[model samples]
Target: MAHDHHEHDDSCGDECGHNHDHSHEHNPTDELVTVRDLIRYATSRFNRNKLVFGHGLQDAYDEAVYLVLHTLHLPIDRLEPFLDACIPTDERTEVLEIIHRRSDERIPAAYLTGEAWLGEFRFTVDERVIIPRSFCAEALADGLSPWIDDASQVTRALDLCTGSGCLAIVMAHCFPSAQIDAIDLSPDALEVARINVEDYGLQDSIRLIQSDVFSALKDERYDLIVSNPPYVTAASVDALPPEYLHEPAMALGAGEDGMEIVRRILRDAHQRLTPNGILLIEVGHNRAEFEAAFPALEPVWLTTTSEEEKLLLLRADQLAA
Candidate 1:
């Protein structure tokens, strides 16, 4: 259960030592023939091993389908059309080996595949950044309606703890007129974010900066400031599943009670926001601690498709007052 490891270049073959010649036939089992069979096998193994999910997917079946489809180069979204189709002998080995590594090593699927999706946006990911799973993506996709009133008026935005720059890229698309500054404390995480920003051809729209929160942007104010900061408490981080440990340690945990980074954001947000600017932060499962920390401030809780009260929204005026 070692957390400090790099992704293999050969798709787990570096550790397994399996050949990947798809044309060559080599079968380890007679049962795992069709895509359906492989999915069933992988799902059974995942459940039996008590593998953890939630990097992007929710359960064993979803993870099996995703890995099977991704391994075969099939459409990740469409599984029915290819469910009964027979998988070739060599390809079956490749797929099974991936399944074995997943069950045994407890590697998150995104790390194995080297990619992740937030809505229709696909990002190149690795161990450097935590997988892009944020409730903020849902809010940004909806244009933060009623709260913002108009998306075009958002002239400038900031994405704090912009690991993988996924939210920043999404913001670029959602608020086309806005200039986004995406900041992360880790230089390695910033490198991954740079790749993602460049992949979306958002080089001009999203600017990646290595900053400890807002320290790098002196006096620069934003119409919208959004963060999915490290809110996992120390105890929670310690008890996280092996899959969760695959993510960067610095990107996951705050101090005790998980409000260390959050406290800093709140302290300086009022100064860095425009008069009517909005501040949004995703404090995953820390509402009780959030309320305890700042009992005087009332934030409008935003709901996503997955969870109720997943994010908090505050206006600049509220913060200043």
Candidate 2:
């Protein structure tokens, strides 16, 4: 499905939001607070409450810090200097109200804050689109260097099933010469993508289209084509945590084996790629299924720090549509 950006470090129990153990030394109404103090208390509350950590940060400490700093409009990476800076009384109250909502409502930190991070780039996110948590973001940040033979040759690109337009925007930023077409089936997701596209001021470089996949592209070809299409199985969707339930299912479930959308992409991509074009798709946890599904064509698997990434690369000729 979508790159959920979940960490395996902790799982959200079914009743995670229902139980809260208030054993922390700091209360929400504690007097005389600093950014560091607020983060500490929120982390403790998060861990004590046993909520899931994924949508943004992997641990309570980092997530809490992000929540506090982002909420206050402080630079998150520059927190070392402002750890002890006393938070304004009113700001502290506003911060805790959200911190409480984060745990109590069982919503993702991104959805709660209405923003998500794909590396340093920020996007406006809500329930309409899946959080911008694809490993492709990291892959793009590396300039897609390891796989692409020549980045300079990548003049035209396509971002299929480009939820929130994260991949398209990031790729456009990384590959300055490239013009990317981002297509998705859902209007709601496209609306969210449109916001991020406009926010990044890339309307000229990136175009958003509402298409199921390559249906609207016709004979258009690209030097690079990338997709993070829905690849989650029906079984997995049913088993996903409630935090995942907040995301749109269209961005999640595929067919019985989770190969429904990916299969079509593989079959149709050859017609849309240049002779030397490269196709990169994130299959996520369906690595084995993908390998088995396409037994003859060998895909160059790309690795990322996030375990959820099962990125594979193939050339246009290898696809042979």
Query: Highest lDDT among the candidates is held by which one?
Result: 1
Candidate 2 per-residue C-alpha lDDT over 1-321 given as tens digits, one digit per residue, 9 for 90 to 100: 123332332323333222335576654356425776688889998989888876768888888988997898766775666676666668888999889998887789999888898887889999999887788887777678866756677899999998899999989988888989999999999999999999989999999999988987778999989899999988888898778889999899998889999989988899999998889999889998887888998888888896554898898989885
lDDT at 180, model 1: 97
Q: Could you give candidate 1's per-residue lDDT for residues 98-161 as a string of tens digits?
A: 9999999999999999999998889999999999999999999889998888899999999999
Identify the runs in model 2 with alpha carbons over 4 angstroms from their true place. Answer: 1-28, 307-309
Compared with the true structure, model 2 gives a TM-score of 0.87
Please give the CA lDDT of all the candidate structures.
0.90, 0.84
Q: What is the lDDT for 24 in model 2?
A: 62
lDDT score of residue 144 within candidate 1: 97
- Prediction 2 global C-alpha lDDT: 0.84
lDDT for 111 in candidate 2 is: 92
